[model samples]
Target: MRIAVTGGTGFVGQALVSALLARGDEVWIISRKTAQDRTGQERLHYATWQQLEQNPALLEGTDCIVNLAGESINQRWSAKAKARILNSRTDAAARIAKLVGALRQKPATVVNASGISIYGTSDTKTFDESSPAHINDFLGSVVEQWEESARTIPAERLVLVRVSLVLGNRGGAFPLMSLPYRLFGGGRVGSGRQWMPWIHIEDMTRVLLFCIDNRDIAGPVNACAPQPVTTDQFGRAIGKAMRRPHWFPVPAFLLRTLLGEMSSLLLQGQRVLPAKLQQGGFDFRYPTIESAMENLVGKSSKPSV
Candidate 1:
């Protein structure tokens, strides 16, 4: 299969691309970097975002297109930074949608990335794909518009994957979150009561591939583990796994002052469920925080994959 991926060099994208290459699929990466041989995977190719936009026909015969391009929301949310965050995501999806429209042989599937933040931060609510977007906050509004930009993609199956907090040894949120724990400064953020929806990196890649292979799986799917945990619970799990103390609770105001609006990424929480994926009979390798933390923190949590 020939696949085109935007943000193919990113954490999630790299994992997904590696998995695809391992399965002998031809991968075309859309990025700013020049093409190079990766692990002798001669089938791997790279093209700039401009290259694809200028020549949409380049994606002509692609079997699938996965868009994971976006600005990182881990820093201070300045006016400029917020604009970059919104534009990076919306523009990437819009560009891909345009490319899909221009292609003579459009891809069979187009998986556009989103986030569980669409449901907003809720301590009392458990969200799934069926929940409505909470357009009240920054991240929520961003996700709403980001997915909206891909509404015009002309694919047989258009998948909107609302990803959650990805836990892994290599990359994603676990390292940063676990750092304090390892250093004996770990504790709950805010009230530590916010629900955290997370998935193992392995499961994250697997779900992307699952969407590509399963014809019946279309529309919005929550890419999270079945068992979600509270922020306090996660910290304690990490503390135990790392043999550290999870006692310090960072004041929410301090985080707000430090990160500005971006603090929501850390302080806010959501209990998201992989309802569609589970109902479709997908099994998760690490379904609970205990299992995920055990694997990621057991052996120093070094970058793997």
Candidate 2:
């Protein structure tokens, strides 16, 4: 299979690219500059976004297109930062959609990455693939527009994976969340009641590949674990994994003052369930917070932790 990927150098994209290559799929990575270390790889190819923009034919014969290109959402959302965030995602989707439309034989599938933030902040609401809730916040708005841009991509199958907080080694949200735990300052954020839906990175990658292979899977598939935990529960799991005490508490006001609107990323969440993936017969390797933390952070040798 010949697959083209945008944002192929990012944390999740890197893993996805490697997984695709390991399975003998030829990969065309769209980036500003080709990775020097991957220079001599046989099945790996690279093209700048500019090159693809001038010549959409560069992606002809591509079997799948995985779009993950976007600016980082990890920092304070300054006016400029927020604009970049929105433009980055929607622009990539629009460009890819245009390219796919110009093709004589479009890709069979287009797997786009999204977030579960579309469900908004809800403690009482349990959202699945069928939920029609619309979140009115910054992150939520970004997700809504992101998916809309993806709708333009013409493919037999279009999979929009609504990702939760991804837990993994040296990637995703684990490193930042685990840092305080390692320093013995592990604490619950806000009221500790906000739902924390998360998934192991391995499972995340598997789900993406599952969508690629399973022709019937389409639309939004929640890429989260079966069991969702609260903020306090997540903190406890992190503490347990690092053999530390989860005793500190970071006030919501402090986060608001520090991060402003960006604090919503930490203060709000959804109780999302992967109902579609489960019904599709996909099994999660790390289904619980305990299991996920242990697998990613090395199980605490001392069970008492």
For each candidate, how many residue pairs have backbone atoms clashing (under 3 Å)?
Answer: 0, 0
Clashing pairs in 2: none
lDDT per model vs. reference: 0.87, 0.87
Q: Which stretches of candidate 1 lie over 4 Å from their true place?
A: 299-303
Give the Cα-based TM-score of candidate 2 against the true structure: 0.95
Off by over 4 Å in 2: 37-39, 299-305
lDDT by residue (tens digit), candidate 2, 120-140: 888888999899858689999
